[model samples]
Target: MAKVIVYPPTSMILYDLVERMGHKALVVSEAVRNLVTASGIESPPLNVTPEEPKKGLRYAAVDVPSGVRGRMALIGPIIEEAEAAIIVEDPGWLTGCSGCSRTNELVRLLIRTKGIPVLDLSYPTNDDEAKVFVQKIRTFLEGLK
Candidate 1:
């Protein structure tokens, strides 16, 4: 099994789907941590305060807008550590937020520049909608096998 670190904005639906598939996922935000734990997914404490990259961890961000501002503050460490990143295309939150748009662009740039495989999950409202995203994640993890 491969070690996987899951980033923020992941709903319980998505988190449970990933964990139930027998994969390791780390929730990166306090809010997400609470969400995952509330949903009965075991999650470790992630110190996003310093925002330093954790060595030897493969990261999969849930969406382009990770709620962090500025390029360096957001993508700097994640890009350094991520083997692959999953971003939601046409994110539901981006519709009314200009900040999200900028963040999305930075995420795209980092993935492209680092040559990390980026799986676009887009918008998934239900379990069925999340299946394709889950499959993409599984496929990406399989390639590492």
Candidate 2:
């Protein structure tokens, strides 16, 4: 099965669609789960471990915001591991809002330049468009080797 990274990373619908299509979805929630569940993380929020930003240096510069770096720490590796990707542009706030414009742009840049098969689709605004979105995703996933 292909390891497909979905943009925004927080979209459960994208995650479910990828899995339902017999592909592995590399998502942020799973990365966060790993961080919080990993031994020695004592932070109260448990959102970003101290070492996470350091790990992010591989993808971003030291001068970048810690938030972006921290996020990249989780997402960068997933992008590297992606065999394919599905990015829904202009996703609704409730659907796939990641809250970091810089990180979002960076993530899109990295994924697009990664040389893998990527399917870029617009967020569906109505029932008809939603049906087309799913069909497009299914077609793209099926095309992946």
Candidate 3:
């Protein structure tokens, strides 16, 4: 089972999608313990500790980048571990925030330089498209095996 960390905006959507695809999905948030608890999803708040940052971690962001200000608190170790990153497309959100765009650029750079497998699920705008995105994600995950 792959351990997945999903970031916000559409965290729940990604969680549900991963779960539907028959994998264990763990949602990660920052200082939103109560909100995450209320969502009834298994989530842990982002806290940089010294314990290897949880190995075998995979991540999926709700949009091009995750978190407010595009500040990804959990990318460093994951990148070092060469974890798979799934980037969802949200052009409007990316354009709305410069921080998001910068963060996205960083993510792309990390993926390309580190040779981490990246899946761009940018074309699913509707329910049908979302289904296809889920299938694509599952395929990517399978390839990781």
Lowest summed lDDT window (length 10), candidate 1: 49-58
Q: How does each model score on TM-score?
A: 0.49, 0.95, 0.51
lDDT of 1 at 16: 54
Question: Which candidate achieves the best TM-score against the true structure?
Answer: 2
**lDDT (tens digit, per residue) of candidate 1 on 77-138:** 54565555555566564322224455556546656677655566666668987787678767
Compose the digit string of candidate 2's lDDT tens values, residues 1-145.
9999998788899999999999999998898788778786677565586788899999999999988998899899999999999998989778775679899999999999999999999998899999999999999999987
Show model 2 residue runs off by greater than 4 Å: none
Candidate order, lDDT descending: 2, 3, 1
Which has the higher TM-score value, candidate number 2 or candidate number 3? 2
Q: Candidates' lDDT values, in order?
A: 0.47, 0.90, 0.49
* Per-residue lDDT of candidate 3, residues 65-126 (tens digit): 33422244444333454445566666344312224556556555655666556676674668
Top model by lDDT, which number? 2
User: What's the count of clashing pairs in each model shown?
Assistant: 0, 0, 0
